[model samples]
Target: MAASLTAFAAAASADTLFGAMEKAYVTNPTLNAARAGQRATDELVPQALSGWRPTVGVGGEVEALISTQRAVVPEADELVDAVINDEAVSGNLAIELTQPLFNGFRTVEGTKAAEARVDAGRQSLLETEQQVLFNVVQAYMDVYAFRQIVVLRKQDVAALEEQVRASNERFAVGEITRTDVAQSEARLAESKSALVDSQTNLARAVAKYIQTVGNEPGKLVYPKVVNLPKSMQMALDAAGEINPRLLAQAFVEVAANSDIGVARSGLLPSAGLLAGGQVSDPDFTEDQNENASAVFGASFSIPLYEAGLVYSQVREAKQRASQSRIQVIEIARDVRRAVVESWNAYVGLGEIIKNTRTQVSAAQLALTGVQQEYAAGTRTTLDVLDAQRELVFSQVLQVTAEKNRVVAGYQLLAAIGHLTAPRVGLKVPEYNPEENYQRVRNKWIGTSVETVE
Candidate 1:
């Protein structure tokens, strides 16, 4: 099944937008790094839950004592004294356990904060995915458009070459001045230089395409115009609700609020259960003695003061929550602005594309008429050169306008947070952030993690 899917994907990569997007979704390092970051974030819940679990510790100690002492004894009214040496060894082994029963609701609030942060991290991952896809779109269009421009420039160079040859022939026959031939030669050189510039741009575009899409671009198919919202107001409304950055910031604000709760919890009392067992062996004179004991009890603790540390922490958390709320408002404003700008660009490019197409058609006819007139000695050589230049400029404009139109449409979609792999109908499997979160949220003990890859 995997082989068949790979074959199908290979077949679909012949000049397609969805193919590039799908490849980027599966293989782009930027997207994959974001995925890994989010997966790491999934461990936060387990970390929080560990607060409710028991902690166990085991230890042993051995010690040897040596000393010299003077001993005195009284026997029937007579005193006696002697020097003595002493040596002793002792050993002890113990195990202890503690289980949290309560912690001033710190654990509860901490768990809530961790969960909120996980939510925020998921949104952040989505935002990263959106950006990766948007970059792919722009890079793809750039390669396609610049590649076409290079072709047009090559054609222009060929036409100018022909003009130079014709002018040399006329000069040889005394029908045109040397100045005309030189002019044609200069124009040909300029056109060739322009071709080189176009080639350079194409090279840069190809590099970007490879970086974003994780593959060298193939011959790209002409992209279809994207479907947009009916009006600018609709686009703005959609962006306001769905823009990933804005949503992520809103989640961050919630997490920050939860942080305040977690900080406040530090001021309250805590309760736990403690249990232990110990065994010890000691040597006394000629006899060995051993002792063992078991202990279990409930424990409670209250915080009275900490040099105002907890209070300051609570204050800091409140300030951060306020900052987060303000950030949400700022992101909303930026999203609205992006929607407006992208909408205008998308709309404006449509008219420019239409106009440039008409210009190309008219320029082609004008150039042909001017060349014919020059051949008949009814026009100057300069007129024919001007007409050819105009035609080439129009062609360049047309290609650029088409490229901008397509790119602007994609930008509008991105601004509205609709440029997702699923929405674009990419054929690759999608990564589910929640799946990893669910798998590890309550996990008790483990080093290995379940991953999408």
Candidate 2:
């Protein structure tokens, strides 16, 4: 569908960052795969729940026997055949059921662990969604910034061209020297080369834009990243509370600890109810006679020795649980670092942009004054060229600063785990992974597909 959505206008492009985010939320392959993975994780709950349910099976078997025997009676002084040949065929049909009554609380703990894992899976998907959306933001911002740079480069070339023409005209009128004209021409050539480089950069940016957003971008509008934390402390708080990566790891720790209980349960007793009904006949091919039977009983077992298997498993689970606990702290530290870096970048770039704007303003005024002085024969051609160069450089720096500032804002939001479809209000359906999870969490005995890879 995105392939078919190749209309590259802002109108066709969905025009704004919100629109791009909405498109990506629905179409991005990475995000969709994460959703599918979470759905699979949801199945674990039902599987664990099945431990509390009954398993039934119906089966049958057939058998045939053949024998031959002969006996001789010595008293009668004669030999006689008693059982020369005998053949018999039999069949059996049975249905057996087993319902677990208790398993040392393994089912309860196993289900708890599975549910925690499913929760962790949901958090992981959230992180993935945040990542995909952030990438889209970065990609589109790159295109926008480069497009602005290309425009500036083109304007520089045009200004240099006009200066060259003016210098030549003054030289022809005996008002400027040949060296002055040559200098103007050289600057014009450099500007053209710079323009070419900027154009190439723009082309590369466009390619990346298409790859990221699943369509060529046209007429893109920069949308502001809203709902940012007002201070560093606020941001840190948000990261601690809602950062998906950190939360996912915390859930993983919980799941691991719960799994320890499941492993320990293996050392305890298990009990179940068993029932069976069967029918038998003396012949398999032909029914000569039949016998029916039904039976029900309680089964119980306690592990006496298992070659240290259960002990080893319990120890392994404990180690994993310890590792998971450490991982949660590790990931929290990482999230905090990301938040600090992104916050600083966002805050610092704002100041840099303000300074660059002032510089651009001064450079533009200086260039215009130099041009006027040159026209009045008070400034050299070199003076005019230098002023023009300073103006262009300042303008380029200003554009770069502005681009960085906008992107940094988004980066901060992403770092704190808030750059998501709902937060941005992208005017599209928010992907509720929970919907699928809820639908399938209690599902039994049906296989239905909702999407394909």
Per-model TM-score versus the true fold: 0.90, 0.86
- The 10-residue segment with the lowest total lDDT in model 1: 281-290
Against the true structure, candidate 2 has what lDDT? 0.87
Model 2 Cα lDDT, one tens digit per residue, 148-173: 88898889888988999998899999
The prediction achieving the highest TM-score against the true structure is 1
Q: Tell me the tens digit of each residue's lDDT in model 1 across 1-453.
A: 999998778766666887788888998898898889899988888898888999999999988899999979787898889778989988889999999998877778778878878888887887888788888888888888888888898999999999999899989999999999988999999999999999999899889999998878886877774557899999988888878888888888888888898898889888999999998887534344888999999999889997899999999999999999999999999999989999999989999989999999999999989988998999998898899999989999999998888888888888898888777667888788888888888887788876545
Model 2 alpha-carbon miss at residue 340, Å: 1.8
Clashes of each: 0, 0
Pairs that collide, model 1? none
Q: What's the lDDT for all of these models? A: 0.87, 0.87
TM-score of 2: 0.86
